[model samples]
Target: MNVSLTSEPLRPVVQTRPVPPALIEALSQRFGKQLSLAQVVREQHGRDESSFSVPPPDAVVFAESAQDVSDAVKLAAQYKVPVIPFGAGSSVEGHLLAVQGGISIDVGRMNQVLAIHAEDLTVTVQPGVTRKALNEAVKSTGLFFPIDPGADASIGGMCATRASGTNAVRYGTMRENVLALDVVTASGELIHTGTRAKKSSAGYDLTRLMVGSEGTLGILTEITLKLYPLPEAVMAATCSFASLAEAVNATIQIIQMGVPIARCELLDAVTVRMVNTHSKLSLPESALLLMEFHGSPAGVQEQVETVQAIAAEFGGDTFEWAHTPEERTRLWTARHNAYFAGVQSRPGCKVISTDACVPISRLADALLDSVLETQASGIPYFMVGHVGDGNFHMGYLIDPNSPEERATAEQLNHQLVRRALALGGTCTGEHGVGLHKKGFLLEETGVGAVAMMRAIKTALDPDNILNPGKIFEL
Candidate 1:
């Protein structure tokens, strides 16, 4: 944690490779209408929620099945053209950008609940199934998938980033829940990793390796994930704090004391104001911790009591309970839409959202200064955190035309990442090292460690054709 990182890099430069005319003709023949060389389709598949705007892919393949993905990838592999996997384009760190020109294989149509073993508490689903869709499919069976990254992102994208969200304090991320994967390697060879069993001492953890590879290694086609029984009792509450420090400190104590709270999210006063106007609710215009507890009624009550006392120690307001399903849904919906709320707060502003996470004990140290620095910089921003597990994000709303504003936001972000690394945390907790964080990845993992990763990528993808120019330069 003491080592200093090199200077963070700017936005990735586009490095488009040539797309063979014969390749396009072959794809047109193979996929017919499913293959699109149209500009709009290519643009739609090439972009995501990130601010970076690169040229669109040369073409897009609307892959509806695993075979379609394999075939498209096989053809691209032959030419060593980049093959970028496109799902629900919800990544904020430029994961979906087509920096190196190629064809985007959009798997949005590959959405189906393949199998459900409610008794075994597991479900197999297609790659393009959204988290909400997966939860809906199993809701009747009293089971749910808890990894909600706020954007209803595709399960395949979530697996690519190893995403976690509000409920991660308890249920964990895709890395923990995903039991197996059907993947198409760079060669377009379909291979299976892991199994549906609860535990496995498999020869190599290919499943884990692929989970957060950011598509530099392979593309996920189908995923089998662990599910949890619906909680018998669920209670939601919001407690306002005097400052961000108090809210974060209270969360630290709750986590340190071993509480099993399902969700603990923090939103700054600025964000609360934005949410108030956006969601049409009158929440206290102050720093707040939104919490949810799930268990038996008595158990939930005990957790509520414990967290309330801990919160009170930090001058938190009396808990505002959301006891009904409608009430809980509304509150969570607003929190999930916090990004949009922030964006709408400033018209014509683009967001550069930062993902920095530190150790539980260092949460206060890591966040308080960043908040002060960002506020002092005079940039419009909204802050939020999953502080129970030491992960937080700040969305800096910058005028895309103003290079000065963008540079200031970048500096603040660079400092924040440095602080997090110094405090025994990661450059990114959930957001993987995409085109934006390639420099930080090296800073956090070091030259030797990243060399190992590059070696693995080369071993799995000799031509660097799968999601090329992402994670790191080849």
Candidate 2:
């Protein structure tokens, strides 16, 4: 397929309006000098990881408290301006993009560990607190938040995306971690959803409703999450495979055998090569499985034995164990660097990554076929995945400056998404359906589900003044 340069820039529908002097005055009265109008710029507000080019908001509101959030939302509602909740800015699907161009509600200033109930196994935190920051603060509490998206994203943003990572196989995703939330509705009402109880038969699960809403419904102020005791012992190991099929099969067997593996990531040969080139680490030019196990000493030893047996059945190479703390950290660090490594493979190429997940039984067949098709198409791509959860990412390196390559990359991405949905998998496993996956969402969830989602959005945001032109647009 030949590509043509799009004459128009990829931007949101633009609507021009004068900044409300009243809103600026109100912000000044409340936040003193903390809130600045100059922070809003075309590049600063609407920027995101997606290729969607957009202008920044008219103003940037720095909210340091729930009340501050309420005030900002109230002013936005009063002026009928769009309100975008910004956290961490790590979202790949254009979650942070201010499509309607109003106020960018930057929440990073509100980061704080509000309270910790080690006994209840729950912690209440301000929305701006990042996973790494929260964990660092709570390290001495003997309990920790388990969901790790590897991006050091804000707890609120992770919840907003319903994100999961390698550890998701055991700890589950944000869908299971979030217990409650403090949200400022579009009308600027402060509402508390859910409870601190272990379980509840509430009328509607509003807390869960807001989990992956992607800042379209309301602004997340505080999040209460379930926590777990730190594991007694953790071990990480990497095993090589001659083929991707063998590596996937080994992962499936281990999962089926009921061994509580902590994390299992799969990296195809192409991805391994990228990691080697970018990270300056020596990696064998073969498919690799980075696995970790968490449990008591005796339990971990037993798991190692079981996993070893399963690996042998699939022609897996000898498992390289990292028992020491530093060794385990180093092992995961290399895996986390896979994305950067992938982007670095091409000197001036940018990446367009797709996330898909299928049931464990079909994972190997789907991934093998999809990857083979991708490579046969002559697209330079890297494959990385949290294979334990049946989810994987394919990163296509493309020179956006080259119209031909961009067209090929987009076509390949669409094909991958189509194939994933056809295989009874989600178009996106962890990444939320931001602007990037809207088409896939329609295909995967069907028009009926899409209509229902639209209905919910309409009910919550009638004015469409919150991250407009994202997820669904008429």
Best by TM-score: 1
Please estimate how well model 1 matches the true structure, expressed as its whole-model Cα lDDT. 0.92
lDDT of each: 0.92, 0.82
lDDT of 2 by residue, 1-474 (tens): 122221222334555445577877876787776666675443575676666566677777778889988988887788777888888888887888866677788899999999999889999999999998998888898988878886788998998899998789999999998989999998899899999998899799999889998888888999999999999988888899899999999999988888899999999998888888876767677999998888899998899999999999999989887879987877677787887787677877777778999888878876888798889878789998888888999888888787787777777777776667666888789988887777666667767988998899899888777777677784
| Clash pairs (backbone) in predicted model 1 | none
Instruction: Point out the worst 10-residue segment of candidate 2 by lDDT.
Output: 1-10
- Clashing pairs for model 2 are 42-56
Candidate 2, residue 113: how far the Cα is off, in Å: 0.4
Could you give candidate 1's per-residue lDDT for residues 265-292 as a string of tens digits? 9999999999999999999999999999
Candidate 2's C-alpha runs over 4 A off are 1-32, 39-42
Model 1 regions more than 4 Å off = none
